[model samples]
Target: MDKIIKTSKTIRAILKVLFWVVAVVSVVILAAILVALFMKGGTALDGGFSITLGNYSLLLNQEYSSQQLTSLHFMTFANVALFGTLSCYIIRVLLNVFEPMSQGKPFSTTISVALKKLAYAILIMGIINLVLQIATNLIFYNVFDIPSLFNADRVESCSISIVSDGSFIIWFFILRLVGHIFKYGETLQQLSDETL
Candidate 1:
C-alpha cells in the first residue's frame, strides 16, 4: 500500500509537469499560427506548413489547391491545437484521479468521479480527432485535384488512418469499469464503518 501510494504520487507529479508543458506548447503553437496568418495576410492554406507522409515514389507530392488562404486548412490547424489542449486537460484529470490514491484513499467517490471524467475526456478527444481527420481528407481531396491513378492508390494509402488510435475507446470502457468498482468499494467501506 505504501509502495502504491508512493508510485501514484510520483506519477501524479510527472503528469502535472507534462500537463503544463503540453499546455504551454499548445498555446505557443496556436499563437505562432495566428501570427503567421496575420503577417502573411492569408488563411492557413496560404504559405503555411505542409507535411506529406508515405513513400515519395508512390506519392505524387501532395499539395493544397491554392497558395492562398482557405478555411479548411485553418480549421485543421485549429483542430490539431485544440486536440493538444484537450490532451493536456485529460492529463490534468488523471492527475486529480491519482491524488486520492497517493493519499491512501483509493476507493473514494472523488477518485471514481475523476476517473469517469478522464474517461469522457479520452472519448471526446478521440471523436474530435476522427472528425478533424475526415474533414481534412475531404477538403484535401476536393481542393487538390489529383490524377485518378494517384488518388486511387497513393492518396488512399497515405490518408490519415482512423483505426490506429482505437485503444482510446477501449481505455474509456476500462476506466468506466474501474470507476464503478471504486464506487462499490466506497459503498462497502461505508457499510463497514457504520457496523463498526
Candidate 2:
C-alpha cells in the first residue's frame, strides 16, 4: 500500500511536469505562427477588430472555388485544414494517453503525460483559432462593412461572437465532452485507488 501511494505521487508529479512542457511547446508553436504572420503580413495585421479590416477584397474573395484558388484564399483554406488535421492527430494521442492512465501503469506514464499535454495544447489552440476566426469575421462584417461569406444570419447573430462561437460551440463541445470524460476517467482512477 505504501509503495503504491508513493508510486502514484511520483507518477503524478512527473505527469504534471510533462503537461507543462507540452503546454509550453504549444505556446511556442502558436507564437511562431503569429510571428510569421506579422513578418509576412506586416504591422497592419495587428490592427484588428475587423475581418475586412485588412485586404477584404483579397482574402475573402480568394475562397477555394471549384477552380483552384491562387493566393490568400487557398492559404486560408489550407490553414483551416491544417489545424483540423493537427487537432484530430492530437485527439488520437489523447485517446491513447488514457490507456496507461486508466491502468495506472508506470510503464508509459511519461509518454502518456506528454500526449495528454499535447492534446490539451492542441485543443486550446483550436479553441483560440475559432475565437480569432469569429472575431475577425465580426470586424469584417460590422466594422469593416463587408459581408461574411460563411453565413449572413449566423454572422449577424449578436450572441455568438467568438470565431468559433455559436455553431462551432455545438461542434467543438463534442470534443470538449470527450475531454471531460477523459477528465472524469482520471478522477475515477484516483477514486478507485483510494477505495483499494
Candidate 3:
C-alpha cells in the first residue's frame, strides 16, 4: 500500500508539471499569433532542429497573404489552446482518482465517479477535436487553394477523420466494471462489519 501511494504521488506530480508546461506553451503560442496578426508584415514559421527557449515552428512553409496567414494562425492557436485545456482537465481528473488510491481507498465512490467523468470528458474532447480539425482543414484548403492529394475528384477535399482512441474507450468500460466490483466489495465489507 505504501508503495502504491508513493507511485501515485509521483505520477500526480509529473502530471501536474506536464499540465502547467502545456498551459504555458499554449499561452505563448497564442500571444505569438496575436502579435503576428497585429504586425503589418507577416512572420514566417520555419522548421529546423534547434535548441531555443521560446522559438516555435509550424509545418507550413510557403508565404501567404497577411489576411490568410492571420486566419490560419488564429485557427491553429485556437486548436492548440483547446486541446491543451482538455488535456489539463483529464490529467486533473486522473489525479483526483489517484488521490483516493494513495490513501488506500481505491474502491471508493469518488474514484468511480472520477473515472466516469474522465471517460465522458475524453469522449467530449475527441468529438470537439474532430470538429475543429475538419473546420480548420476546410479553412486551410479554401484559403490556401491547396488541392487534396487523396481525392482528385473534389476541388477541396477537406476530409473529416474521427480520432479514435480505442484504448480510452476500453479503459472507460474497464473502469465501469471496476466500479461495480468496488460497490459489491463495499457491500460485503458492510455485511461483514455488521456480523462482527
What TM-score, over all chains together, does every model reach? 0.77, 0.31, 0.73
All candidates' lDDT scores?
Answer: 0.74, 0.50, 0.71
Per residue, candidate 3 scores C-alpha lDDT tens digits across 32-135 of: 87877777855354333222223753344455556656777778878887887888888888889888777876666677678777878877776777677777
| Candidate numbers sorted by lDDT from highest down | 1, 3, 2
lDDT of 1 by residue, 1-196 (tens): 9998999999999998998888888888877766655554333343333435454433334333334436554765678587887888889888888898899988777988888998898888888877877877766655554244354754555333445568879989999999899899999988988999
Cα TM-score of candidate 1:
0.77
Single out the weakest 10-residue window by summed lDDT for candidate 3: 45-54
Highest-lDDT candidate: 1
Q: Assess candidate 2 and give its TM-score to the true structure.
A: 0.31
Question: Model 1: clashing residue pairs?
Answer: 43-69
Worst 10 residues of 2 by lDDT: 61-70
What lDDT score goes with residue 175 in model 2? 56
Please identify model 2 stretches exceeding 4 Å from their true place. 1-72, 98-108, 131-196
Model 3 segments more than 4 A misplaced: 43-62, 148-175, 182-196
Q: Which sequence of candidate numbers ranks them by TM-score, best first?
A: 1, 3, 2
**Alpha carbon deviation, residue 6, candidate 3 (Å):** 1.9
